[model samples]
Target: MPHPNQLISLLHLASPALPIGGFSYSQGLEAAIDSGFVTDAETAEVWIRDNLLHVQAHAEAPLWILLHRCWQSSDHAGVAAWNEWFHVSRETAELRLETEQMGWSLARLIAQMGWGDEGLRAALLAQSPVCLPTAFTAACVALGVDAREGLTAYCFSWLENQVAAALKTVPLGQVAGQRILYRLYPALQEAVAEAARRADSDPPMLSTFSPMLGVLSARHETQYSRLFRS
Candidate 1:
């Protein structure tokens, strides 16, 4: 078990204020809003929650844990192999762009911050190869966060970014956004706990059946009416 400060470390890595530039990418929430899948406040709630559970929680959170393990073992080569899986397995262009760009940004930030940690640096060694969650969890490890805490924070940050974007693009009222977050709290908690429990297992796996969302994100690249970078 980790010390209490481990939780603080995780929180720092997943903060909305983190230099990873996560706020700049809506993860296609903008496209979903355009397509009416996220027209209203309630729908926004569903979209964020569903996307987290089906996509980020399942698909990326496990990888965050895996990357954390890799960092712990100082296995930069293994980290690269996993990043290869992350890059090619991304189903669409926007998804690929989101991960790739954020990964590079995080790598750059690590250099500027002079984190001075070889393991963290190794995990994101390649420019275009590292995944977002991998980079995120790397910061957590550098700060002494536990692997499970890192995974939960990684998953939660996805939901936070979506809901925050919806507040701006949909112009959802503050009360409405808070309500949606509250409604998602239970599921979010369960997913986080589940992620923590499974952190040490064989590559963490989550569902990835959001092809329509993927299509919207890809379409967003050329979208003449974009409110978010995607």
Candidate 2:
């Protein structure tokens, strides 16, 4: 059984209300909407699902697990290297800025609240522009969150945010949003499982190549009108 405190911490970390500014960014989904790639609930679900499966499953989830292990063992150098790797993996300026901004926000929040020991907290803040997964895994390690459970929470948070973005951008009804989220449950589970396998591979591999996301994000930079930043 997991500790109640750890469970609570996971919930706290995953909450959209965690003050990390996750709600303000559509992560290229808005651009996709602009391009008519995600006009209705069905298309919206497909767009979000594809990225969740292809980009996040291959990249962020497994990298998250590795970062978690690094934090668990107090490997600051390893943590820093992976953090930079994530920064470079972002294929667009908007995407890169999104992770850096969210990561910095979470790092500041955690440090202010004294979530970790002094030394660890100092090291986290030292990363300057820490990526989201690095700061998030650091929080998980500090709070005793199980690695697998943390990955689930991470992916779920992302799924919820994407669905929420779709609701606003695609202008879908509440029920439609729920339905999309409901249908993604299995894909989410598969993503978490794949992340575990990749993380445990003889030599872990991490890569994210969502070309449409890059193109859309770049176009969003000059989009005449937009709701979300990215």
Candidate 3:
């Protein structure tokens, strides 16, 4: 069991109000809508759920676990290597920029809040444009959050932001958005579990295999009258 304070810290980090600008980017969902892949609440739920299971579960979540371990052990080299890998893994320009901006924002916030030691903060800032999972994992390690709990929080934050984007762009009603989120609770758990298992592999193998999301995100860069950034 985690200490109450640690759990609280996880909640705070996961909060939608963290000011990392997570709400600004829709992570290609907007393009999905623009392209008619996601229109109503049902399609919206399916879109988000599929990405959550496929992309985040196989790649970002396991990457988060690896980054958490590296941060915990103070392996600056490993951290930088994985950070660069994640940056390269972003399939589109907007997607890449989203992580860079959000990660940069969170890195600065971590420094301002004094969450980690001088060395850890220095190492984190060393990455020219740290990816979100790298920066987020650093905070979790500094704050004493368990790896599993930290990844869970990360996924929840992503899910909440996706659902919020659906509400605005898909124009779903509040109740409908809630229903979408409510239905994906189990999928979220399964995603985290799969991420853990993947991370535990002898040498973790991460996938960036969501081609449709890549295409849609690229399309979003030129999307007309877009509501979200990506």
**TM-scores for candidates 1 onward, in order:** 0.88, 0.97, 0.98
User: 19-107, model 3: which lDDT tens digit per residue?
Assistant: 89999999999888888888899999999999999999999999999999999999999999999999999988998999999999999
- In candidate 3, position 45 carries an lDDT of 94
Backbone clash pairs for candidate 3 read: none
lDDT per residue for candidate 2 within 1-230, as digits (tens), equals: 77569878988999999999999999999999999898899899999889989989998999999999988888899999999989988888999999999999999998988887887798799896899999999898888898999999999999999999999888999999999999999999999999988889989977787788899999999999999989
Weakest 10 consecutive residues of candidate 3 by summed lDDT: 1-10
lDDT of each candidate versus the true structure: 0.74, 0.91, 0.93
Off by over 4 Å in 1: 1-4, 194-207
What residue runs in model 3 are displaced by over 4 Å at the alpha carbon?
A: none
Q: For this target, which candidate reaches the highest lDDT against the unseen true structure?
A: 3
Who wins the TM-score comparison? 3
Cand. 3 TM to true fold: 0.98
Candidate 2 lDDT (Cα, whole model)? 0.91
